[model samples]
Target: MASTVADVAKMIDHSLLRPELTNEDVRAGCDLAARYAVASVCVKPCDVALAATRLDGTGVSTGTVIGFPHGSSSARIKAAEARTAVSDGARELDMVLNIGRLRGGDDEAVLDDIRAVVEAAPGTVVKVIFENAYLSDAEKIRACRLSEQAGVAYVKTSTGFAPGGATLADIRLMRANVSERVKVKAAGGVRTLDVLLEMSAAGAARFGATATAAILDDLSGRLARTGVATVRGDLSTDRRMGPDR
Candidate 1:
């Protein structure tokens, strides 16, 4: 058993990256993040300023995505986006790596693409999204190596727009591949408290979730009932998570 509700709350980055979300929707998401005191609200690039202004002094960091669902943008373009986002007050930047390039084994291109954004934003927390659904295990390992080499803060599972999302197997693999300094962030399909716990046990330290309210609400209820909400999965074992035990 591990973690209080606050611990779980701090692990989540409330997602507001959907294309259909309006400015008002982003504002509401910011409010929700502030109320929950989550780690950050990852909004669309255009919403960075709005989210920053709304979340000011609330201790919830403002974040945005780059090259987004598709990692098709040029390295220079992605770097420009990163700089603009930082100027708009975004403290965190999540960038998608070039999936096609990675698949084609263009290691240098992939590494340079990630490095461009990291260089553009000097002090921000940059998370590299692998969009693992399309990668083989070997590819995943390579991606992790590249991310660590590029000096990223976190290596994420998916963009949530991909065909598949975070899985326990991928989380474990990513954690095993990266060094202690490089954290793993699970995103996409993390809709329940049990799922998050499973991922955490598998070695994910950060989570990107749109189902923030329900997951936290469920934990709050459990804590209220039992006076504690603890994760049962053991980090030491990193065992295969099955049916939540």
Candidate 2:
């Protein structure tokens, strides 16, 4: 299928979760997401309020992580974090699952941990990050089942702080295991328009990316060359470039 610039833009959740980013960086990221009209801006917990305020009325959502990088936080703490994040205007929450507990075969503990956050925010979208880098194929499948059972909105691949990120194979596996109600989000190392298309073909509905600008720019150029009309109801105006740029 031929994807327009808007289709590619909506797939991206512009990631601003790097540890060293300052408030200024967060604001800049929010601006970029708004300019391109990407799906949302995923920021650090402390930056959620800032991002929400900046992105208000821009049609882009504000999202943050809970028990990020490592999913070792207690269930109570994670639940509290979820409540606080929602209160701070976050519409989406991407939380890491307790890898240790999952690996140790404590399925109930893992399921409860996910449910704690889901229960915290009733209507908000909750994505359970599996951190697939450290998990075996069996473990990954089990995590997908647990996420589905917990009633999360999406099953995410990684935190971007891990050794590896989303792979086409992992996404396909996750999609195959989860029910239609549970969507798949591919994060970490999804840097190009080609990769985004590949993931989408593999049944991924969303993506986490730090290279939103480059990907969108590339998509725009491609669309201009093909003279394809932009997708329905997208805000971006078409830019028809000559052969020489």
User: Each model's TM-score?
Assistant: 0.94, 0.93
Backbone steric clashes in candidate 1, count:
0
Per-residue CA lDDT of model 2 for 62-143, tens digit only, reads 9999999799999999999999999999999999999999999999999999999999999999999999999999999999
lDDT string for model 1 (1-245, tens) is: 56667879999999998889999999999999999999999999999999999999999999999999899999999999999999999999999999999999999999999999999999999999999999999999999999999999999999999899999999999999999999999999999888887788889999999999988887777666665455343522122322232
Residue 161 in candidate 1, Cα distance off native in Å: 0.5
Query: What lDDT does each candidate get?
Result: 0.91, 0.90
Can you tell me which runs of candidate 1 are displaced by over 4 Å? Answer: 229-245
Each candidate: RMSD: 3.1, 4.2
How does candidate 1 fare on TM-score?
0.94
